[model samples]
Target: MNRYQSNPLSLFGMVLWLLSPGIARADGHQVSDPMSLARDLVHRMTFDQKFILLHGDLGVDFHTSKKPSGAIGSSGYVPGIPSLGIPALQETDAGMGVTNPLNGRPGDGAVGLPSTLATSATWNIELSYAGSDMVAREARSKGFNVLLAPSVNLAREPRAGRNFEAYGEDPLLTGTMAGYAISAIQSNGLIATLKHVAYNFQETDRNFYNVMIAEAAGRESDLLAFEIAMGLGKPAVVMCGYNRVGTVWSCQNHDLLTRFLRQELKFDGWVMSDWGAVKAPSDANSGLDQEAGAQLDKSVMFGDGLKSAVRAGVVSQQRLDTMNENIVATMARQGMLEKHSSSGQPAIDIKGDTTIARNVEDEAIVLLKNDGNILPLSAQKRLKILVVGGRADFGVLEGGGSSSITPYGAGIRIKADGEGEMGRRYVDYLPGSPLLELRKALPNAEITYTDGRYPSMAATLAHQADVVLIFATQWMVESFDAPDLSLPEGQDQLISAVGAANRNVVVVLETGGAVKMPWLHDVRGVMEAWYPGSGGGAAISDVISGQVNPSGRLPVSFPRREADAPRTTIPGFDKADGAMFDIPLIEGADVGYKWYYKHHSNCLYPFGYGLSYTIFSYSNMNVTHQHDVTVTFRVRNNGRADGKEVSQVYGLFPANDGKREIRLLGWVKSGLRRGEEKNLSVTIDRRLLANYDTKLGRWVIPEENVMLVIGRYAGEAEIQFPLHLQRAEFSSLDMVKPH
Candidate 1:
């Protein structure tokens, strides 16, 4: 003190520290060890303080004078307690990128980034990691310590409202990509939250719908993907889904939350409730650490409900204590309490973001068909192109909801008429159409466009054009499910008219998920340009014009007929059923390819199925382990041009214990040049060999030979490899106790 008194600033600091004990604790010599500091802070917190710490601290922004307020004072930022010297943790929603909040102001549009489907298409884990890092940097700059992202849910259904937010359908692919995203976000000194914890595939009646999945199906198809994601990502927080299951809602299912996620999977993260997902007091019994997006407009009260539950003995104090400990631990681990000087500048570089986004877009476009080599449209003057359909000019390229990201002001606009009308009514919820970009990409060609319903008095125009391109769009929104897989109202009619009128007709589908293609046979070429994002228009033009070869694969199975879908039997799907809709997951884990292959149902397109401009060959399939197999293949660009090919590997365990069809073990993407071949290897694990036996209530390995298949799609390149399994005393210990 005497030495400090010599310096005026030191003396003032000493006085300030002495005057405020809270400040002293906050400014207390920086603790080099975060864990020890966290322990010390926890040891000093009172039970009530601990409970508060367990609750989520949400904010509209940092400096607003609002206090933990949302609806009815329930929606506000969680304040830091000066007495306890505990800083509130900040969290933000970012499955794709940082979504700017929409203030109640005119033209306060939401910013959107590329869809998860587009990100996954890049097949570049580093790009996803970079994207997550950029998002995390923005969040941290705004005082957020947690970023809820890397939605690992399998894209089981194409019509799913949230499919664009998740990694594609394959478990291994989704898992690997999600892992990179998690690492990127967490690496930035923030906690990453993997969402919709368990089987949350479809959004149809998501909140109250019951998923009646068989244990086996659930494990192999849906749960296997999540297992891979959880193992790789190792997120700091897990978000429970709102859907209901056999005995309980996913959010309130203790067997799923505590036993399965925490125990078996070894998920050490804190569990948070989805917005307004907690239906009753029992929901808290699932060991949920925090109630997020708590609103006062709803009947679900947070503070009072929690406190009353404790008072009424519905919730044990120990359980509450444990939740609090988890929350505190997560906060401490993220270093949320530590304050730092602001750079007062953007954390992410815009140029770098654009570069990454463009690169990802180039990789995601899938070229389904290209007949007569019309593509890579020659730069000749004789070519006359006619682009039809309202969507062709102005279609929604990205999905809606939390993941939506709008780039900064006046982005690269395409020159097109009627594009503005597409946003007249739904301006707040649509993406840029692909027409302008396509026209720009092909400046030398004569491009004509129409905006009315397809098949307008445009048959004459179509016949006159050298080639006719029809863009078909489908609209699927949140809190609602798609009615069917058929192309939207006038789309099929237009395709039929245009195809019949012109011999060289190409169909470009701008849909979020799979759609029934009744006009498949009529069209000469088809491109599934799924919600391409900001650069979607360019991507579509590139693929169609042969500038970029389509490498995208179907993440989920495409049903040939509507009735073939697994959820066709779910009652109340088409009818209204209040808050409790009858949207049942009757198919269980056998979704997408699993369901199709298991039932041997005919599909329009199998999972991981996609056609490229060039041809590829699969060969050299071999088994490397008693339980695992390595399928080596050569991807030859048979065409005159070079392209990339995704080699898929499928595994089938014999139905010794009445098992279902073959399952997808792993896949690899190979790049090739014209007339060049590349070697690829895909391995399957022993765990994937085990099947869930309901009779025995355990995962058992039957003493039977397993079959392994390698091809571009399911049941395409058929091969049989048998592995003998030694039967042992298989106990239901893991199934019953479940971690």
Candidate 2:
């Protein structure tokens, strides 16, 4: 089979009359048509003025990129023309929250939302939307009109440095969650960007590597994710990758930009290059609409260089016109041209936003193991508890990178290793100490704390206490991926010593992605509190103290060891720094659990896997496939406690090679009272069931016996039903809101 068998705003006019602050929430719904306004303004713009919209600069002086006068210092800034009433695009690093890069705005900070992996774990679309809306509102209030986030990139490489920024491994889950994030952010009149298109998977050699993925594999895995997100969110801007999509840089790849994104998927928004990603002026012809952070490039690829190209007929007038139109139309689509930004912007409500963060993590923190059901410890108990390590007495751990958020109340910083951003990769710790929160949660328990730097000291305390609680941390950052799955900083040794010393030990993990638990056999319980955000400590207290039921599932599989990874070693990890290397993505559509399923190997924890305090059973399975697939099942809470359940459905299809391909069709998160039975239904998009036929350039579901594997996690056979499917091909994907 050929590689690509399957896959895949101008409202500019209204001026001052629409500038009322109260109408800031107004979107294109309440504004004049965007395209009409853009087309009309295209004729009014001067020849030189049109070039202004094609490039932007890294608008901060963190490392000598001079910001334009009156421009907000941030990740990227496009100066607006006062004559045209075009507002400047002030973009901030979001996805986690609005990060104060280098504490640019002193005393100003954003509310930290849990890592995207945590949200991906929640499997809750409504929760994702609410959290993103809160962050978007905060960004707008802080004078930023664009959020450089909602990265819909698939987690093709588990060890990839940017995995924390993405929405898990599955294309459907990542795309759907990111789509909601886009919609929520845009609804607040701020642009949410969907980014890092086409196999920008690993961060090692990110700026120089050339990814040579099979056309079909590229289309079905990562590109499918970008496609699904575009259909739902309709984002105003799409950020191209820094690395090459094949031999051609993604910013200048005509097949990816013009044919796939612009033509096939009907993505009308402008394509913005990742900071410093542009290669040449001819990138304009290949569908790159704008060069972001142009100062980061060796030479300005768009400003004077692009002008020269157009003069020499290397870039056509039509391409430049389209680029200009897209920029203006997007500004209008988000009501940016209509609404004026105030320098005296309202202050962010950190307290209110933190509440939203807590609510999200309340359902997002997964209970990996509750052996002997030892969790939900009673507050009235008089037992002595030992709190060890992870700086639990100080603050919670968070991954370091562009997405790391500065705390509004108080931020803790520990200088870390690396050559990132002027050798300033500082490890951040969110406020709200887990030890203090636990003290409040269990007022009667006698609790003692230890830093856990000395394993012997932690072991001694663990032996003296009736029960032990260890807060473990693993820091995953951008620029460099984790070396292995084991906990960093000798944390596993500390955990092992403590686990051996205590009869009852419960571990709370604050990490960026999956980690190996060498002491799993010694621990009584394990809770994955993935960078739980602003309310992280309190959320951990709520779950362990029985205040909230745990429902979050694993978005990515946890391998037994790094050796079990799809790629044992990162591509070009040992290669020369400035030399280009080839990255052949051989995994194809099988990523995360799919890879494990194909190998018939068992991971530490499977995708969509989590343990809850209460028991729930699935029964009365019914499947109907007509226009689409609908799965209805009855969920009954067998335990006496009320809880929430996430029922996952995986599709099993026969492959031409006799092996089968497994994909996540859909899932539903339902709430159930004690002993109550509820009927829940999940509608599967047909495109998810169909494979991209590179030959036909369409999604096809070949005639075969398709089985629906419905359970809490992949491979679990709670309810399995088989139905034969007729060959169905779709020329287009329906981006309708999922049920």
Candidate 3:
């Protein structure tokens, strides 16, 4: 007769609660509390039901139709149990943004967001969060609970095709930014995944390439970022990449999947495979719970192969149960079952969308070089300008593939004067040119443009113009990474030809990432206008016409030549065997600015390098805590231009031998008007000073002297401060957090 006692009637009620479809709604409890419901439902599921959930509902229309199939077949969704009312969980593609199919465009549904490279340049966590929120809204609205995003991969090579979709080369920056983005999406009642589990840097033979990396290098640069995101974001899902290390593929590597990701990193979410990433059936035995983007070849995700493995004692039933438990737990964490019954909200607000896109584009447009102070062009006069290049009239903005976005309306276009003929042939998939937008901004200017491919034609136009703006674009599309860093064949030739005819030339480059600039010396001005999304034309015009000062910095290192790249030793880069190159990663932990700083090699441009219309100075750097420091500086618009300046803070750790070297720790962006000075402060944590020691098998902090550097960018003249650590042994966990 006790209230808490489970007598016959009470036991019957508990059983009824376990099987009731209406229990969640009948209890008047919020559906958002999926964990509680999942715990209850999982206890009642049969072994077969648990196995089906773990392998995912593999159907041809899974991502498209929002349906689940019991078996791994390319057909309509086959219900696991019609009477049980257990709906299947569906996932969608998204490293940059929501990838929905549109008019036969595979994986195109909603208006995608900007690439990771563009977001990284902005260096604004809030912007990334907003973008992810939009992607989540779109994904949910399209009937998908899992939104795969925040691809936290390292940008080790400049020529990597996927570079546009990754944050940057630095582990701290990439992890922090990706973590914020994932958190934002997941917090909105949807699940955001952190992907390419480890060391999937290059796309060349991505499906079968062997990424030979030293354990130290992988831990320091690649794995460090993944661990940061996992600890901070706690993504609902982790997608395994299609790369191999030593002899084990990532999807089939027990050491990586079980020992590292699940146990060491303490990740409790389900691990899914990249499209066709699982090479053999045994891959699932390595702690992978699901096969996402499952193709037609894998006949039964949880059928014959799994049954055979269990019967043969290759994979125990306990392991299968554990995997299923993880999947069910993740589904509960994502509120998949509860949210599945309701409809979703809209993807974006039209007005807010354009404004955010423009702001991000403005922040990401890097001003590389400006001599004679020609930038922020005087808008008072009807300047005679000539806009020429293949991508001038039709803007070459944003990268292609899954990250591509189609804005609500036609983006702002640059306008030009005279008989300028826009390129009729669309060679690539980018949006319109900046010329149309520039023309609209400068209606009074007498502008003329011609296809710069013809030297004589460009010469004739340049001779008659007072200023020439050349749009040099590099389009690196799908299934291939760039061969070299050089500008396209015709672009380099056109720049050289036009520069000879006109000294007042402004080169605007539209590329996914860095490209070698052989003609940098010839042009008077340069702008690294990365594929600037939909409103790129307007952003370019604003920078040129004194409306917006360029504040973007080089997120990745710009090598002076292709040979300067660390991966250049890999031969047959352009051939089919290019994906099979066996070159060693001798550079190891020293990548990007690290390599340049250590070796004292001259680069075309150092990482985080950017030019502003104004000037800023660093001083009064004070170390408050042994593990933390706050630096105060002054940024003055010395130039007679209203613009913004980004103050970069770098930290240098003295080697165990007492030698001094500097590396970037953190940075802040500030805005100021002409002749106005603004005070700025930035803090750096002690953990940013740790280095991975191969012999020690852990991150080590030198007990010797540590130097603090504050500069405009990497390799610049830096203001220095010194400190000493009493103890040197510090784990990555201690370093990421301050005392």
Candidate 4:
């Protein structure tokens, strides 16, 4: 039996394997302390064996050997010492699903969930856990033990290509969602890695730049997000990014890796370097436990070099011992020390998994505009519907790069680096298409489909239909930042021509991040269906056909143009060679809606902004305080249809507090029947009201009157209530426990 199922200790008790160190083994047998066990294992190892364990060992095996009967291609692998009873650890890519190519077996690869941004839009922590659990289960079924996922970095840059992989600008939202995902992944017997640590907010020359920001600025924003996730999830591993923070690379920065993550946040996990991120052997003492993918990239910084450095007293023997102990302890905590293998060709619960994906999309599809109630298109009217552009007949556009997954019947698009393209790309398409699903859902309507190859031709076709549904696509790939927010491949021009040709037009945007909607005023309705996953097609069909009401909200604010961004210009050079420069986070803690509110700027769409098909009224608000602040309110679906409303709460602090800004304290999703009212309570963590006082070396909760705003969106609120906080301060680990 698998230790995960048969072990007697509860999940929380298992954490004592690191702390108590005197607990009995999984079997009914007495064992030495975990530190003694790790030290004993290290004492038996030779220099060569220890050297091999420090870096990656999967390159030769993956390139020249055959994979296991049900395994996918390797992401990272480190061979264990067989004589010492340690088993190898196999890691896989992504948050959505297994992305590596699987062995030839039925259901080898699994379906994907919606993007992190989409799930964040739902503002439901339980749903986030369910989605991440599904992904971890599929990964374990494919013989993987570690999932490099739940990127918690803030979306500080609007043009970042990998925004779909992470939650948005607000630290509370991003950290809360990531905590749920990490807990879900590890709870299913897989190790979850909190990745791209610190400020990996942009992809432009990411590997060739240093991020310069004040310590206080980081403590309030990006760094705070990491602390919140670490406190809640207690992830098994943390993957350091490639960039430098200040003068040292993040993989080897003692202040970030040791002083902040370890000493302050109290994260007990091991730290690993991003692929090819190691730069020096002296990094052994900088809090990095292992170097991954160095062998594949042909990097010679660690390995024999580290061993020699330790032998020469350049890198201390104590440092090497500490690293080895951290790795072994983490493995033991995750039950990876035993013989690990998957049940071949897992018996997939098709219906259950599909429902999970569909429900997430149902909650995440944002309706930006529904002028004159043009949406929920009347299927009973038997009207002519023209579905043009966005390659909807082919597949949904999956987010590009390392996190891309191959669904049951997915297709591939290979675009080489040429002309204006930034890098070589391979994009996978979700199996089912929206056009086909829409046809299946509304069989009574005259539904015509087109690839929209030519703008003029597409416009001509739009004129013949009673209503036009133009699909606009914006493709985002890793290793580069988008040059601008404009839709790629002249998609804006196509939307303009189609909107001009038909007055009753609705636009559906398939994008990784925010894109400029040039024709927003011209269209009757617009939906931001961000990179919805395998079940996206059906979700969209349900929303447009009035089968499911749209409930998703924008996680990040949408600006009218590039200049409206907090930082107009980012540091970059034309050359591909490795050159370094400093990229300063000038706006500091002011990001997304905080920046807009502070500057009084014009925004295309505000954060937490989404239109629902049914109208919902908020009333009878009340606030209570214990260890945390709890807000209760009555929500009634006033419109004639049943729908779900995401109620958000924001804290408005005194204007004199420059270090802090208005924050999303908490949110809840309430599903109501027509004219039905339900009372819901959302808890606001008291820690959010505190600010890190560097001088005092603690989080200080000031005694002041704070106005809590219950809002339909970030900028627009329905009601305001006041609270008085008594002055208090807390140590680093005070709020680490789950609220």
lDDT of each: 0.63, 0.82, 0.65, 0.78
The sequence of per-residue lDDT tens digits that candidate 1 reaches over residues 1-739 is 2221121112332342233211122224333554455556667776667556544433543234344443112122444555755665555667656554433112322234467766776555555666676667666665566677878788666567777778777766677677667766765667777878677777665766666667677666666666665555556788887877674877788877887677666665588877667766556788677777665215434466777888888988767666666665555555455555546535556556555555566776665667776666765555788888745565444555555555544433232222432232122323445677767777788888875363656677888899888877765444545667777667787788878888898888767777888877777888777666554566677777678877777666778877787656334466564557544565565556777777778888777777777877655556665434455555566777777776666766555347546766766666677897766565554446677676654566666665677777776764445555565334333322211
Give the winner by TM-score: 3 or 4: 4
What are the per-residue Cα lDDT tens digits for candidate 4 across 508-606? Answer: 998998988887877899999988887888898999998998888899989998899977755673645577888877877777888787677778998
Per-residue CA lDDT of model 3 for 564-633, tens digit only, reads: 7776732335547425544356666666777777667788888888887777655556666544556666
lDDT of 4 at 429: 71
Cand. 2 TM to true fold: 0.95
- Give the TM-score of each candidate: 0.84, 0.95, 0.85, 0.92
Candidate 3 is scored at a TM of 0.85
Pairing residues by index, what is the TM-score of model 4? Answer: 0.92
Q: Once model 2 is optimally superposed onto the true structure by TM-score, how far is the C-alpha of residue 631 displaced, in angstroms?
A: 0.8
* Model 2 lDDT tens row, 1-739: 2111111100110111133111244543554567677877877888898888889887677466556666666788888876887878888989989877766676777789999889888888777888998998888887888899889777777777788888899988998788778878877778878898778878888888887777777777788888777666677788898888768888999998888887787776788999889999999998999999898788888999999998899998777888988888778767777645465566677788899999889998999988888888889899799998888997788878889988877778888864645277888899988899999999999999989999999998888898899999988888787667888889899888988898599999998788888899989999999988998889999998999999999989988888787788888788897779887776777888888887887999988999999999989999988888788888899997889888888988776667777899888777788898877777787778777888988888888888998888887879999988889887654542211
Q: Which of 1 and 2 is ahead in TM-score?
A: 2
